[model samples]
Target chain A: MWDGILTGLTTAVMPFNLLMVVVGCFAGTFIGMLPGLGPISAVALMIPITYGLDPASGIILMAGVYYGAVFGGSTSSILINAPGCASTVVTAFDGYPMAQQNKAGKALALAAYSSFTGGTIGAIILLFAAPALASVSLSFQSGDYFALMLLGLTAVAAFSGKGQVIKALLMTVFGLMIATVGTDITSGTTRFTFGSVDLIDGVSFLLLAMATFALTEVVMTVMRGQHNEQEPEMDMAALGSMKLSREEVKEVAPTIGRSSVFGFIVGVLPGAGATIASFLAYGLERNLASAKEKLKFGKGALRGLAAPESANNAASTGSFVPLLTLGIPGSGTTAIMLGALIAYGIQPGPRLFMDNPDVFWSVIISMYIGNLVLLILNLPLIPYISRLLAIPRPILIPLILFFSITGVYLVSFNTFDIQMMVLITVIAIFLKLLEFPMAPMLLGFILGGIMEKNLGRALTMTDGSFSFLWDRPLTLTITLIAVFVLLFPLLSAMIGKARTRGAEVAVNEGEG
Target chain B: MSITKDHIGGLVFLCLSVAYGYYAGQIPLLPGDEYEPFNAQSLPSALAIIGGVLSIALLVTADRSVEGRLKLAGYDFWLVAKLLLLVSLFAMALPWMGFTLSTILFLVGGYWLLGVRSIKTLLVASVPFAVVLWFLLSQLLDIYLAPGRFFTLMLGV
Candidate 1:
């Protein structure tokens, strides 16, 4: 472990890798501040750029972008009340109120401090947690891997929010269907090419990610006529003192500490990313608060702003845990990272720890550096960075669209991919209108081929029987967990309906 | 019953699954491959059935509230359609006009579609950005971006 840490340190400190981190942070911050684009889209946009570099530097750059984007999301949420992403939506509940109170500078400072502490704490925990988990996961077999993928897919569906579980599952199915489009790697036979040469290779991960996230998100903004809306007017002169008072510091310290740990735990759970963590952490803080403090939650209580800012950053770091250890993404952003790592010919799992220690360790080390960069550099640059948001929508929109389209085109150099991107973007837009979640579909697509491979191996080992799913205790346990996760939402929904019906019947009886 | 977004989505997916299942059957297998545990058809077949079942479940338990209905009003669908068409056109133009010229035209068209009528704003935004990007790819990175078929034919270089 010590040797691994040293190896990671050496790679992370290399001048070019360090430069990549800085550039990724700046780029991610700029993209993430744009409304309708989140860390997912921001990271997706970086996929093309990363393809030109080594795996270690590419991942390091992406890690930096992930943290920067989350921080940038908080900035937009605080300043304009238009959250750059869903995770930072909780930040606006009190952050915008603080901005309105002429304490935008102070709010931004506290957010930075809390985020810095949260991310550092999460990083420290991840240092110990990732290696331990990775070592344990090294024992995982094909059956176990199949079960784990099952759990991943089902967990994503279960956590997709109210009334969206079935929709998410169907989307996951859709993703798996899309995954089967190209030649079957095992048999070397074409499946769904429909006589088109482009279909033989299946869909490119870069194209799907860029189309579904980057292009679709930007087009959605235009569809909503947001392209014509005036840019946010940030009054930098009105930003008050950027310092937190001694009392203010003491007040939020415990909240930050508590939420950081809480948020990290939630983040470590597969499919429960920063958005849920931040919301849960804020709710927990509010519930724990005294009546007077509770009353101040939505009105810009220092603790209110501190809780979510800390948790979301902490959760952002925590999401990397499953990605590094089990090769299962804990969030949509990490899912994209998983796809990128795969594109680099590096399979991220337990083997990644031994096979590519530099890639593994360097990414971990760069994450801490990323958080530090956000604090020491980004906080001071907020006023200037916010100014970039002033670029006319008509101009900015096309530039982003250009990047997203060109990002995929540069790779593969296929004109058909550009046409495919437009088609997928149209489909994505339709799905978004029906309120279907896109992340699960992406996660399913990413895990599909691996899951199929593992399942085939396990089935062959078991001599064409499904008994392997249950014969091995470890695989059985994982399979059972997957089943429970899949059914939990449905069971609860049924119970709720029954309870509602009972209440109505009792009311009718009393009235009679 | 009045249809909602959920109903439409469910119906679409159900149809998709049926078609997918039919195609899954059409995937040819190698000799004696079916005797094995799994093949190319297995996962797709399972997915199609699961997709169909889930679609049915969604239809059965869909949100029936008025708020769940698909509302198409107030959206700038015409502008969005034009923008998507422009993207398609850009793709078509790439092989003809090459990267730099196509990019410039795409940006100019996008700006215009978004209501930026100023020729100066359009030119300034598109030209330098496209040239710099092209230079970065072709010179700094040494990526061989083709000069388009027309250019190769005309210039004979």
Candidate 2:
């Protein structure tokens, strides 16, 4: 473990990898300041540019972007009360108040410190926990893999949003269907290519990712008109020293600590990314703080800013856990990362830690370095980052479109893939207009191939018997957990709705 | 006019599921696979069946609260259509115009189409961006950005 860490640390320090971290952090922060672009889009957009990079370099860039985007969210939240993403909504809860009180610099400082603490602690946990989990997962077989993948799919579908469960699952199934294109691996026969030699190799992962994420995003941005983002009104006078007094640090220390742990735990859960973690952290702090301190929440409480900032950054790190160890993506960003791994022909699972230690360790070490760079660069540099918001939407959109085309083209120099990407993007936009969740579709697409491979293998081992699903204890246990997780929310929602209907009937009867 | 997005979406998925299931049956599978109970077509067929069920469920309980129309006659509608047109044009022209020229034209035309009026913004955003990216992708990364068959024939490079 120590050797891996050292290896990762050394790889992370190499000039090119270090440079990617800096560039990724800067770009992420700058882009995150935009009202419309969040970390997911930011990471997605960069995929084209990172296409030429090695896995370690790409992961470093991803880590930097994750941290920078989270911090950058604070900038918009604090300055304009418009968070770049939903996860930063809680940052605005107290951050804006602090700015209003002319303590903008103080708020920014606390946010930076708390983010660093959360991120660093999260990285530390990841360093130890990821490998341990990977080793434990060495026991995973075809059945276990199938169950885990199901659990991943279920968890994301269950929690992605309210009233979107069926839609999410349908999309997931559709993705699985899409994965069936081209030659069937085991059979060595064509499936869905329809006589097009272009698709005999199946659809490119880059094309699907670019289509669903980047291209769909471009269409939406153009159609929605401008975000009409308001100019950030940073209290320039309050942009003074970003120093934290001893008492101030002492006061928020416990809140940061608690939030970091809570955030890390929440982050590890599929579908519950930074937003939930931050909100939970803030709620926890509010509940535990003394009456006076509690009153300061959503007003100008330092702990208020500290808690969410820590949790969000911590949660971002925690989100990487499943993607690295299980080959299961927990969120849209991680799903894209999962796609990246597949593109590099490196299947990310338990074996990744053992087989591709350099890629795994380098990424892990880069996380530690990336967050450190963010902390160092955030303070005194935020005002400059805010300047990026002034870039017109029209200009940025076209440039992004250009990059999307170029990026997709780089993977395969053919024009057919580009054309397919555009067509898929249009379809994706229509789906989005109908309120479909894109994340699950992308996740399903990536996992569908893996799931089918494992499902077939598991059944094969059992001689075409479905009973093997239950004959294996661990697989059965995992599948049962998936079932419970899926049904629990649905059942609760149904019960709650029925009770509400019953109450309404009773009230009308009484009136009659 | 009273139809909602969910209604339309549900209908589309219902039809799509049937089509997908039919297509899955058309894909040939390996004969005599002793190692596995299922073939490549098995998972896709199962997915289509499950999708059909979900689509029916959606169609039955479809929400009508949200408005469904894209307002085809409206400005926003045209904006989307125009963007699509520009994208299609770029894709169609890529082989003739080459990566550099087509990208520049696409960005320029896209900006103008999207209503960016500032000439300076358009030029700075489109022309230089295309050139820099040409070098970055072609020169630095050694990605083969087609110089267009027309350009190749003309320049004989």
Q: Please list the C-alpha lDDT of all candidates, in the order they appear.
A: 0.93, 0.82
What DockQ does candidate 1 have relative to the true complex?
0.89
Q: Pick the candidate with the highest TM-score.
A: 1
Clashes of each: 0, 0
- What would the per-residue lDDT of candidate 2 be over residues A1-512, giving only the tens digit for each residue? 88887888788999999999999889889878776667887788787667677888887897788778878888889877879888899999999998877788888888888989999899989888899989988898999899999999888888766778888888888888788888888788888788999999988877888778777776776676653333654545757667889999899998899899889989998777898889889999999999987788888898889999999989998988998998887787888888888878888989999888888999888888888888887667888777766676676677777777767776677788888987898789788878888888888888988898899888888877877568878878988989987887789889999999999999999999
Per residue, candidate 1 scores C-alpha lDDT tens digits across A307-402 of 999999999999999999999999999999999999999999999999999999999999999888888889899889889988999999988998
Q: List the residue pairs that clash in candidate 2.
A: none
Candidate 1 clash pair list: none
TM-score of each: 0.99, 0.94
Supply DockQ values for each candidate: 0.89, 0.63
Whose DockQ is greatest here? Answer: 1
